[model samples]
Target: MNAPTTPSTALDKHTGEPLRPTDGQLALAEAVRNGETRETHGTQTVPASRYTDPAHFEAEKRALFDRLPQVLCPSALLPEPGMAVPHDQTGRPLLITRDKQGEAHVFLNVCQHRGTRLVEGEDVQCSSKLVCPYHAWTYQLDGRLLALPRADTFPGLDKAQYGLKELPSCEAGGLIWFSPQADADFSLAETLGEDFSAFAMEQSFLFRRRTHTVKGNWKLIMDAFLESYHVLRLHANTIGPFFKDGITAGDTVGPHMRSAVGRLEEVEGVDFTDMAALRRVITFAYQLLPATVIVPSPDYVNVMVLMPQAHDLTLVEDFMLIPEAPATDKARDHWERSWALLDGGVFGSEDFRAAELGQQGLESGAVDHITLGTLEGGIKRFDETVQEYLRAVN
Candidate 1:
């Protein structure tokens, strides 16, 4: 903890309503008050094996990816009553369209007759019913079999039994989440708490998308975003000037966590009473458990999702969701230039480069453990939460 940067209050600006920071953020602020910012969680470390073990990775796939509820995409992707899109990670497809009463439903994209994919390609699709290209087996938006081609050829066939497999899904905080298994621990309101509304999730729409196929363990890539300690060094030429080094608050929400750090020059003195000033001084990151990270910025939200491919390989999709459309060509050009900085700078060359090298060292069996300082508490908490989840899974 460090000395108090500013006196604390819990009130919003306009409404004077209560404002709550995540547990992690509050701890960090309190730590700063007590003069423990740089050294609070110092001297903590985890076994290096956790990062390199193939068995552990396999367990993660089963315990976390297969069992828990993870984000499929933003709920805004399929807004219209007949919108459908393929699940990028699974390539198995997902059908999300509303019924007559305007209720959303999700179902498998496979035809029951011959396991043919119902929809193909990348782009939002629209149709009241999905018809398989292979056999013309059709299904309604609600996942009920509407018709099967050549019905008389197949006698004693039950349309109800062959309806597309309905996966248990949840939409809260404006995200579509589901699991491979029959059950999942899912509650959008609970997972994100009040921050769900704070994120303005309903108003957001996908603005940009890019994928990075990197050679590194997924956890290694995630650890890069867990703390602000490296911002001054790795991002020195880029975001380094924008953020304070080793000043952050981390809060754990169930199996997930949130971290917020002050802007570099603004940390020494802050005016918590001025909401605009307060916001200008800090940035927030929501680590959505296993595979997603959402960072809420002033203009847009940054979402990073990792699709694990192997023990030391992962596919990362970075999505930027903005609430408003660009009104003019200049606004559009501004975003284009900003994305160039982002895609090629922070997450691009610097972060992924580090991820690749980190895996090499961890896999070399050279270090027994990775030591973490008090300032690196975010990483410690994140690793612990992950291990906790893995241990509890059955």
Candidate 2:
């Protein structure tokens, strides 16, 4: 894939500068803006209006989903030729399939007959054409209208005018991404940049999955994942003791951010050969622009992408990625066991409950604002990026 073009004299969306400030200056600016007057003890809060305001949510939908590189589906799940996935959150159905010429094309999955949906399930295969289950309207795998049920009944019905609506899509980093709206001038590789794209695409799959509906705002869920500060307190009985309390975060081009939590030297009761070696089990979290977090563990990796359903509800999909091939069953089994513990125990139980409770708090208005400490730097950067996007669209 061709690399994305980076302008030599482009200004940053937030700072409007060709170069960012030094580390110390940046930290100081962050502290001041966040109302942190004290060196390490001050804090500032984001108003509750930012969370509960309907207009703000609408702005987010346009700036983030309509104009960002979002992970729509995982490549492993839709690896077959005629597979299709429907994204109801975006108010459009996604038709993914390989054409007769052996290329992948993604289109708006809607039938011309009364605008009904064309595909329903996952991993479906059709050799000749994709026939609509509703009214038997047929279309070729390449999105050409093949046969309508009653073609002779209509006099001037143009088959050429009623093809499936196509969208710009690309497959990279073992994931499929599509823009829901037109006027997207950037490619997936361009949005992800060359070095990061190479690193992610080079890695293979370990395990993959889709998460159930999570009750919270999409930004709320994303904010929860952006930082590891809550891990020590909320996950105290779970995976908290294994990680350090502090967080290190950095912002990248686009809406992406990378974060790392310090690893604990030793857990009280756990026995391991080398404490230094055990520190290799650090958590690496990468937020892929708008709504996806790629979390890499020592044994495996998991991706959490948020799909907004309403003002206060979202669907979070989780996918696990591993090396292309594993040498031994023991290594694979180890990966699975580790994944189960993290997914079922930590995220599904602890973090999810916290988000729900936080949603309740936001709704209650007991506290008008939510504070972001220095430890939650990634969350602050995410909010700033969202603001930048809204500014662009406006």
Candidate 3:
């Protein structure tokens, strides 16, 4: 491994700390430069039914999505106190709110009074109280029932008991995570929180976010980020030239996975002390178990949270987080161009389009299984992790 020719005193623009590669990152850089990749001993295949079977999809919802903790949104979505948003992508209407204390909560969107949805739409609503559209029931941002019209009409009505039903939730690593199951455990987030915090996610700025209803199984969308095998072919015009073909390294964090790709033509001779030089040579992608993909670029990070709506449908919430909000016209233009290239061109046009096309082909009953090459081993590993979750419930 090439050592830093000179230790740099420059601080990281985002975190204000002297930037250097970790031991693990150094190892990955060496592997990429040596033309080495993490591969399975033999070719692997996943059943087409895994992507198209209705029964299997429902099982996944019941065993995994319902029970496991999910990333509701980035903390930047609710950047300020007294902010609330409606989220219905999990096949259940949910309300996410941040109280005056800046604490986050996830509650069932249903009104406690008459079971009517208390909130509607995806836009953020900044208010101290949430008023039910029907009957005028009002609740605090923390899910406490505050007031209701015509209170005298109801006998022995306890306002305390009528608070909105809340689920297990916490804000960590600049993201809001919640479980749909009332009794779900959140122990898994401890490690993942540390990993995300390492990237200074909590301090980042939310530049832009948009939701898409894509025609593909949620896993199909996730599969695109786990491998670099298709980068040169599928994204040849957009991002291919910026990355080395078939040169990648990865490791698993329990069910989660981390992958790294090198951008430089030769990483062996590059200086590691200079953060700028090191960043130009390597990029990291993190797969938060289930369906969240976090890819940090040189200047910004992209987070995609996938919600499985059905066997062939997925709700994708895409977020682009930057170091800070743009303050000048030049800075805004730079961030805008980066967003357009990545969010609009690379992911929307190339990666997601490929997933939709793959779904269409699989739907036609052409192949029993989708074969994976050595370079695409991350997909096979992901499938295995998912199967472990399904098996636990059975």
- Which numbered prediction scores highest in TM-score against the true structure? 3
For candidate 3, lDDT tens digit of each residue in 280-349? 5678898887889988776577889998888999988889997778889977787788888877888888
Q: Candidate 1 regions off by >4 Å?
A: 1-39, 88-104, 188-193, 263-278
Local distance difference test scores for all models: 0.70, 0.63, 0.82
Instruction: Provide the lDDT at 5 for model 3.
Output: 22
TM-score of every prediction relative to native: 0.84, 0.76, 0.90
**Which scores higher on TM-score, 2 or 3?**
3
Candidate 3 runs further than 4 Å off = 1-36, 263-278
lDDT of 3 at 275: 53
Off by over 4 Å in 2: 1-42, 100-102, 122-128, 149-158, 187-203, 245-249, 262-282, 324-335
Ranking by TM-score: 3, 1, 2
Give the per-residue lDDT digits (tens) of candidate 1, residues 1-394. 1111222443443465644444444455555434454435338888887778888888988877877777777666776677677665643466665655555666777788888878887677778888889888888888889998789998999888988888877777667777767856676435574564445565566778888888998888888888777888998887787664436666667777766676445555664434334444566787877888877654556778888887799888787766556778976776666666666677889988899999999888889999887667777777888888888985
Choose 2 or 3, whichever is better by lDDT.
3
Local distance difference test, candidate 1? 0.70
**Candidate 3 lDDT score at position 325:** 88
